[model samples]
Target: MYQYDLIDKEFLADRSAEFRGQVARRLSGELTEDQFKPLRLMNGLYLQLHAYMLRVAIPYGSLNSTQARRLAQIARDFDKGYGHFTTRQNIQFNWIKLKDAPEILDKLAEVDLHAIQTSGNCIRNTTSDPYAGATAEEVDDPRVWSEVIRQWSTLHPEFSFLPRKFKIAITASAKDRTAAKVHDIGLMLRKGRDGTLGFEVIVGGGQGRTPYVGPTINEFLPTDRLLSYLEAVLRVYNRHGRRDNIYKARIKILVAALGAEEFARQVDEEWAKIDAARADLPTAELARIRAAFAKTPFETLPARSDAFETAKANDAAFARFVRNNVKPHKQPGYAIVEVSLKAQEQTPGDASAQQLEVVADLAERFSLNDLRVTHAQNLVLPHVKLDDLPTVFATLQASNLATPNIDLVSDIIACPGLDYCALANARAIPVAQDIARQFADLDRAEKVGELKIKISGCINACGHHHVAHIGILGVDKKGEEFYQLSLGGSGAEDASIGKILGPALPADKVATAVDQLVGAYLNVRNDGERFLDTYRRVGLEPFKEAVYAQAD
Candidate 1:
């Protein structure tokens, strides 16, 4: 985890102190609700349907035990006993009181975390591969680039109030775990022909009322020129992106209207002008940042140990966990363990205080004290020694956090739909729960394999239904919940938007409909083919025929 410097500490304290006064003025009736809206949003507070929701940023989803503990404290002291971990790798406390927000921000500041840049029309948290440092396939940790962008974008005077809120996600891995394609600006890190790691910049990708996969503005951007290139892209967007219609105000709309070729040209033209304005990116700066993320001292070990194997043999539950929750680590003797938030019949991504505390303890004991929250809404201990897997598995099993279903059908990504969100048309949680239950059997789920079953209550795609291998969007049909299905969509190296299957299915028949769809996929699929690959080969006609054929 990156430690906050003196400047960062002072910045938060100052920002909180200023916001405290702003809140006082608002609550004292000196500022009306209308007047307070933008200010509060700037501070990461949203007045949703029931109550105020406070979104706290977890930068690049990295945290220490202390920071994790503080979040547990906040959940216990202020709102409910739990908090929702979002797709953005941020945490949202749904039922927040107006007056206590500043105090919450103040508490967060103590741990060097704050909600600033979490909302408003500025660059949001720079997400990356959650498995960045742990993955063997990484070119470099994407958080290195993420932190660079974070420092560059925080309260940037020029781009503060753009036409729409901007998001940037980077990934160093070949597989895209961060959903980089759906961000306003997506940076894919790769080793270029010069043997130096650089970014493949994608622009105008967004998901809301209208979804779009960003086009490649630059195929290769040297690490040194990253900030300059980003500034050029933003400048182009700020000058010409829609201001006439708020709905179409995103850079995605602009890119769509301009066409990718024209958009790339405009960005290139803008780069020549603003590239000179950016300060020379110091090589020492990146090194200093990298040093902050240096690998902690690890105990030397011989080839693979027996504790993991012995546990797998002795305990079926632990075996399932090792299969689902544990991932290969970069270090010889270590592993990446997922503390699943997707337990059956429970709300997806909701971690109670006790669970958070247990995870923090396990992170310290087993993972050298680093905790990461995945974009998939799960807690990860990125450096667990293979020798300690049994103990960690047992402890997590006791808390019911050891469900070994990281990328399975049951490990669904969902948003706080009608239950907490003002924009939701129907409840997404219950539907997710139903889907999870429908595939609760471990063997059956494993057989289904590597499917991204995502749900959104409405068009915002907070649940990321737009990127699912099997996308399920909840819609309102005469006051009843109906689900619209889409297939062949992906958020990885080859990103493509999902195509809708057909008419929406009634809520009651949704799980069965999904079953039929999956069954159809299984029948036509090649040997060991994933859902999307099969869909691509056989096309949607098979899925459409299967889903509608059994419509009762």
Candidate 2:
């Protein structure tokens, strides 16, 4: 993990002190709610339906054990006993009190973490692959660039207030675990034929009321010109992006209005005028940042571990967990273990204070004191020894973090929805909970195979429902809550927008309809095909017919 430099520490401390004063003013009536709204939002505070929500940035989804422990402390001492991890690879405390807000910020500063840029119209947290350095297919670690961009954009005066919120996600892996296509700016690190590293810049991708897969603006941008080219792209959007209508304010809208070719030409024209040498990082600084993320030490060993094999042979439950939760790592004898936060009937992406502490302890023991937060709402111990799998599994089980449902339907991604969010038109957590109960059987979920069910309370698409294998969006129809369904959406390398099945169904029928969709896939699926593969092969008619056939 990148340690905060002296300047970074001073910046956060100063920001925290300033927020403390702002909070005092708000509480003393010196600042009205209207006056404080933008100020609070700049600091990642939101006034939700029930209470204030505080989102804290976990840069590039990377955290050390110490930082993890601090998050656990925040959950225990400040808000409710748990916090929800968001699809943006950030965490939210949903019940923060106005009085305690500054204190929480100050505490977060102690651990080199803060809520800066977590909300507001400014560039939000930069995210990357959870398996970045550990994965085999990456040409370069995306975190190095993510951190560089993080430093550059933290408080850039030029682009502070864009037309809308901006997001950047980077991925170096062959598979797109970070949903690169659904972000405002997506950077894929790659190596050229000559073996020089660079980025493939994709722009104007986003999901909300409208969803789009960002088109490639530059097929291959030299690594040294990354920041300069990015500045050029942002300059184009910042100048032309709409402000009259908030709905049409995002860069995606601008990109859509102007065809991709014209958009690329504008960015190229802008890039041609700027001096890349001035915008690019110096060689020494780049080396320093890259050194900060060098691969951790690993002992030379055989690809497979005898103890791990023996344990898998002995315990069927452990074997099942290994099959579902453990992933292959770049190192020969290491594995990446995913700690599923979506326990049965629990809110997806939520972890109790105790559960956080348990993960911190486990990471310290088996993962080089480092952990990662996945966009899928799970935690990863990225460097666990294969032999430690059994002990880690047991510890996770004790803490209610080992559900063995990594990519299953029950491992849902749901937003705070109507339960806590004022923007929500209907409840999302309840629907997620109902679906989890409907598919509680582990055997049944495994049979379903790699199903992704994402739910959002509204069209904001915070839950990323647009890219799930099965998507549920809640809407208010004549003051009654109803849910809409979409199928065959995927967030992988071959990203595709899910197509809506039909008209919305009552909230009560959502679980049954999902069951029907699953059954329909099962009935038609060929041997060894997952729900998504089968859906792509068979199309939506079969599933749509099954879901609406019993509609009253």
Candidate 3:
């Protein structure tokens, strides 16, 4: 993880002091709610339907044990006893008090964490593959570049307030764990024919009311010129992006209005004017950032762990957990363990203070003090030793974190919808909880196999329903909550937007509708076919017919 230098520390202190003064003024009646809206938003504070919500950025989803402990402390002291991990790999404390906002920021700064750019129309946290340095599949650690983007984008004078909020995700692996296709700028690190590293740049991808899979603006951009190219792209958007209408303010909208070819042409023209030498990072600075993410020290060991194998053989519960939560790691004797926050009938992406502390302790004791927050709203102990699997699993089980459902039907991704957000139309968390409870049976859930069900409260798509295999979008039908279902969406290497199935069903019918879709999939699926594969092969008609037929 990148450690904060004196300059970084000083900057945060200044920002915290400024916000403290702002909050005091607001509380003193000098500033109205409308007057303080933008100021609060700039600090990642939102006045939700119930109370204030504070979002804390976890850059590239990286967190040290110390930082994780600090987050748990904040959950316990300032807000509720839990925090919600978001789709962007950030954490949100939903039940925050406005008076404590500045104090929370100060606490976060102590651990080199902050909530800046987590809201408002600026580049949000630059996310990357959660298994960045731990996986062998990636060309290099994508976090190195993500950190570079963070430093460059944070409080940049020129692009501070764009048409709308922008997001960037990078991945070095061909598997696309970062959902690169659904970001404002998706950078895929790859080696060229000459063996020089560069990026395949995808632009204009986003999900909201108007969803788009960003087009490839540049097929190959050298690593050295990343900043210059990004600058060019943003400059084009800043100059020509829609600002008159809030609905069509995103860069994706601009990219859509102008054809991809014309957009590429304008970016190229803009790139020619900027001096690459001035815009790009110096060689020394790049090396410094790369050094911060250097490989973790590991003991020499054989490929297989006898203890791990024995534990799996002896304990059926442990075996199930290994099959679901344990992922392959680059190190010979280590495994990447995903701790699911979506326990049965609980809110997705939420962790209690005790659960967070347990994870922090586990990371410190067994995983070299390194932790990662996945875009799927789960935690990753990226370097747990194979021999420590039993201990880790036992601790997680005790903490209620061991929900053997990674990428399973019950492992849902849902946003804090009408439960908290002022922008929401209907409740997403309840729908998600109901569906999770419906599929709580492990045998049945495992039988369903590798299904991703994402739910969004409204058209903003914060829950990323546009790219889920089975998407549920909550809507209001004459003041009653209803859900519109979509199928075959994926946020992966094979990125595609899901098509809507039929009319919206009432909230009560959603879980049943999802069950019908799953049953239809199981009936028609060929040998070894997952839900997505079956859906792709059979198309939407079969599943749509099954869901609506049952509803009727």
Candidate 4:
């Protein structure tokens, strides 16, 4: 994890002090709601359905034990006992009082964390693969580049009042776990043939009223020139993106209005002007940043742990944890353990204060003090030892944080829909809970194989519905909430938008429809094929027929 430097510490402390004053003014009515809204939002405070929601940034979703524990404290003292982990790899406190927000920011600052750029019209949190530094498949840790973007975009004078909110996601893994294709800008890190890591830049990718996959702007930008090229992209968007209509203001719409080739040319032309005037980032600065993120101490051990095997042999619970909670790590005898937030009947991503504290304590005790937040709305203990798996699982179970369904059906991704969000058309949390309950059988979920089910309250794609193997988008028809299903979508090495499954299903019929769809996939899939692959090979007709056949 990247530690804050002295300058960073001073900057955050100053910002926190400023925010505290702003909060006091708002409470005294010196700053009206109209005046304070933007300022509060800029600091990641939202007026939600029930109360204020304070979103805290977990830059590139990386955290150490101290940071995690601070989050636990915030949940305990300021808000309710739990926090919702958002799709942007950030955490949200849903019950924050307007008066207490500044105090919460103070606690966050104690751990070098703040809420800046988590929301409002400027560049938002930059998300990357949760496994960035540790993945065997990455060209480089995308966080290295993400940190650069964070520095450039935070409070950049020119971009603060852009036409609409902006989001950027970067990923280094070949599989695209971060869903880069649907972000405002997506950067895929890759090493050139000359063995230098740069990025394959994609622009205009976003989901909202309009959904778009980013078009490739540069095939192989030199590693050192990333910031320069990004500046070019932002400069173009900041200049030309619509301001007349708020609805039409996103960079995605602007890029689409101009063809991809022309957009690329515009960025290239901008880059040429800037690149000629500015020199490459100094070698020393790069080395300094790189040194800050250099790998944590990794101890070598046997390929597989005999103790882990013995535990698995004796205990079914440990066996389940080994099966689902664990991911292959780059270092021997180490495994990445996913702390599942999608426990049955709870909000999909809510982590109680006690649970958060448990994870923090476990990270400090058993795993390395490092933590990660996945784009799929779960936390990761990225450096857990195989020897400590049983103890960790037991501790997590006691905290109601242990559910051995990392990528399984119960591990759903859903937005804070109509329940809290002002823009949402329907409630997403209840639907997610219903589905989790519907597929409560663990063996049944596992037997069905890997399937990605994403839900959005509306077409904003906050839940990333467009890229799931089974995507559900809620819509309002004659004032009633209904769901439209899509089949064959994926957010991976082979990303594709899903096709709709004919007609919308009523709220009551949704889980049953999903059941039919999953049943159809399981019945027809050929050997060793996942849902997306099977759907791609066989098409939506099979699934659609199964889902709607009852009507006939």
Candidate 5:
């Protein structure tokens, strides 16, 4: 994890002080709600349906134990007893009081965390592979580049306010764990023909009402010219992107209008004008950032752990947990453990203050004081030793955090919809909870295997429903809530938008409709075919027929 320097500390302190004065003026009746809206939004505060919500950015989804502990403290002291981990790998406090917002920011700054650029039409958190440093499949740790982008983008004078909010995701691995293709700028670190690692830059990809899988603007860009190239891309968007209509303000919309070839050509033209040496990070500065994420010290041990194997053999629950939550790590005797926040009948992506504390403690004790928040709305202990599995599992089980359902049907990704958001048309959390309860049986859920069900409250696609294997978009039908179901979507290496099945079903029927779709998939699937594979092979007819037929 990157440590905050004096400059970072001083910048945060000044920002916090400025916000404190702003909040005081608002409270003193000098500023109306309308007058304070933009100011609050700039600090990642939103006025939701129920109360104020504050979003804290977790840059590249990286958190040290100290930072995690501060987040838990914020949850306990300022807002509700729990916080929601969002699809962007940030955390949101749904029940925040306006008066406490500045204080919370101050607290966050103490741990090198803040809510800046979490909202209001700027580059949000630069998300990356959660397993960045721990996975063997990666070319190099993506976080180093993510941090470089973060430093460059944070409060940049030229691109501070664009046509709309922008997102960027990077991945060093061949597998697309960060859903890079769905971002405005997706950078894949790969080897060029000369065998030197560089970025394959894709631009204009986004979800929301008008979804697009961003096109490859540059097939291979040298690592040294990353900032210069990004500057060119942003400059093009800033100059030509739509600003007249809020609906079509995204860079994706601009990209669509110009076409990928024209867009790339313009970017290249813009790139030619900029000084690459000045724009790109110096080699020494890059080395400083890279050194901050040095490999964790590990004891030499055998590849397999006898204690872990024995625990799995003796305890069925532990065995199931290992199968579901434990992921392969680069180190011989270490494992990457995913902590699923979506337990049966609970809201997905929410963790209580105590649960957060538990995770922080676990990370400090077993995982080199590091934790990662995933885009799937889960927390990861990135370097747990194989021998510590039983102890970690036991602690998680006690805290109701051991929900052996990673990538399973019950492991849903949903946004805080009508329950909190003012922009929501329907309640996404309840629908997710109901469906999760329906598949509460672990045996049945495991059989359903590797199914990603993403639900969005509206067309903004905050929940990333467009890329889910089973995507549910909640819509307003008359005065009631109806869900539009889509199938065969994926956010993986094979990225594709899902096709809608039929008419939107009422909220009550959504779970049953999902059940029908799953049943249809199970009936038609061949040997070792997952739901996505079956849906792709068979197309939408079978699932559509099954769902609508049952409705009729």
Candidate 6:
């Protein structure tokens, strides 16, 4: 929804042109693979197992239909027929050619999109709640702060090339949909004592080798001082974070070693030295940014849509979809419609070029020309008219994008795994596909209710397996693929790392083990309890027993 200003357009043009020259030199033998590695990474290009991968950043998960159409075009022409939407709310093209990379970047720049800061040891995409402006629960739109951080952190001289890659997620809602706690820096927007807006800053939250939920560094950092506080935290991490061991290089490790109190003290000391006014955004700039995100022209209507209710009452499928895929909007007669990419037996987040185009068209027609990418690998038409639900559903159904399995077991989150990523030890997509096929019954999936199954190829936790209700990690055992399961994990406000159930199961046995675990949950769950609620209430013993019993 935020239009690119002249400066923004100029910056992208300049950056794209510069990258084009760099790419030309690399392709012409002036730069070897080793020489081009860092350069390519800086621009979000990765040489995967089969081909080069290009990750394009969708800032704070917001994009216009024009941008969406451009992405579809890129998926159609440049790389493959589809693009993978990631947990970071970014898009990854798996079959990118090194030679076509520059042209792709240029094309992205045309639509005010690029892969800048999508990779390397800098602040990655600053994500926020997808329902930012649409949700009524938020204190303020987190995208306002997210954009501020994005503009400030992009190519900042002091924080570039940290000990490890840094991530920052912000959310204003009481419900933490952004997985804020798993980021290197998590900014929870809140109102202070006098009703003034501020951030409850959490530092050192990460989920890789050593999973950690960032502890609260500042109980209340005033809105104006956000940048200054963030600077102080980054400065502290940069000064003392591990450099000798890449595994221990993340800020989370530093925070754990030093303790939260000491980390907070250090950040405070650093904050005291810096001139806050100099680092903080000016009022004019803040106002300008806020103005860009002003509310859309939502019509004044009654509390409920008669047409929507009538359709829901008439059609079972529509009713089921309404129950699962449609979310309440802050505006009356409007809905936040989730376009699920996780269809039965499909790769979780893979959207075909045609599917992308269809979504773009739908967004332009129904969602005020704005679309949002959720952290859960789903797309959101954040402001769809309730009366248009049937038409929207029919269009999506035709395109195979209307999957009513949000937060269900079959609605899995999975990484590229051995299929595309070089770091992966096992194939995650096939495993996810198997599980989805096993539980293809929509009624059965809805009965299971709100189960998040996240899969990762390796411990890198790209799929955010660390925070799923049911976490699966793929490991290589003597050249054979094995799947390890974890339980009681969540990425919500009550964020927690999953606990391992038992030994890793063989690849072929994973689906059976998952079924057994689900059965155990159903057996032990209380009335109206979801999988996570049941897991939290009963602990992992029941599920573990059920799984191991099947093995025995």
Residues 1-552 of candidate 5: C-alpha lDDT, one tens digit per residue: 788899999999899999999999999999999999999999999999989999999999999888988998999998778999998899999999989999999999998999999998888899999998999999989999999999999999988999899999999999988999989999999987788989999999999989988899998999989999999999999999889999899999999999999999999999999997889889999999999888577778789999999999999999999999999998899999999999877789999999999999999999999999999999999999999999999999999999999999989999998888889999999999989988888999898888999999999999999999999999998889999999988888789999998899899999988899889989999989999999989999999999887667
Instruction: Write down the TM-score of every candidate.
Output: 0.98, 0.99, 0.99, 0.97, 0.99, 0.99
**In angstroms, how far off is 430's CA in candidate 6?**
0.7
Residue range 416-458, candidate 2, lDDT tens digits: 9999999999899999999999999999999999899999999
Tens digits of per-residue lDDT, candidate 4, 366-417, equal 7778888998999988888888888888898888888988878878899989
Local lDDT at 441 for model 5: 88
Candidate whose lDDT is highest: 3
Worst 10 residues of 4 by lDDT: 275-284
Residue pairs clashing in model 5 are none
Clashes of 6: 0
Error of 6 at 216 (Å): 0.8
Better of 2 and 4 by TM-score: 2
lDDT of 6 by residue, 367-482 (tens): 99989998989999999999999999999999899889988888899999999999999999999999998888888888888899999999999988999999999999999999
Candidate 2 overall lDDT versus native: 0.92
Off by over 4 Å in 5: none
TM-score of 3: 0.99
Model 2: residue 397 alpha-carbon error in angstroms: 0.5
Candidate 2 has its poorest 10 consecutive residues by lDDT at 295-304
Per-model RMSD to reference:
1.3, 0.9, 0.8, 1.5, 0.8, 0.9
